[model samples]
Target: MNAPKLRWVLFTAAVTFLIAVLLTSFFKEIRKVDTLAATLDKRMEELVGEERKTQKLKQDISYYSTPEGISRLATEQFNLVRSGDRIYKIEVTSQDNLQ
Candidate 1:
């Protein structure tokens, strides 16, 4: 083969090898970015759930501050009776009997 032709072939082969190496590294970087995006998505969903829970707790706090809610809590927690109200007491022998 002529010297010029041999040099051209060698140059083409070297360029092809360089391109292949660059493409391999590029694809590896893309895979890493995809994994990071998936992890970020999971964390974003968790944050959304926590925000919803926080909003629900805030609403409950607002409700519990109302007079009706306070009265209900008092009756349930302290077994409070209104004026002239009769209270009934039941005796149970065993847990199964109560059920």
Candidate 2:
């Protein structure tokens, strides 16, 4: 409890407190950066998925430009057939409708 000894002890305690404060702040900043990086990584994955879908749609559009692809789409969507194709029609009864 001498004056010189007391001064040295007080200085050491202050330095320790300052170091603790700086370390706490540094760790907090690092955690924030880690969280932001994770968020950015999730967004990048979503963008990659959208890019793949866009590429697939573009390929489909290109396929639709061809003559055979257009004919297939017309047959599927409009039920159109080529020349000399026969058509059959069926009548549905109320009992068959329930079944």
Q: Against the hidden reference, what TM-scores do the models get?
A: 0.71, 0.74
**lDDT (Cα atoms) of all candidates against the true structure:** 0.92, 0.92
Give the lDDT of residue 36 in candidate 1. 100
lDDT of 1 by residue, 1-99 (tens): 646788899999999999999999999999999999999999999999999999999998898899977877878899996778788999768877667
Which residue pairs clash in candidate 1? none
Model 2 C-alpha lDDT per residue in residues 1-99, reported as the tens digit of each score: 646788889999999999999999999999999999999999999999999999999998999899978988988899998888787889767975687
Q: Which candidate is the best by lDDT?
A: 2
* Model 2 quality (TM-score): 0.74
Clashes of 1: 0
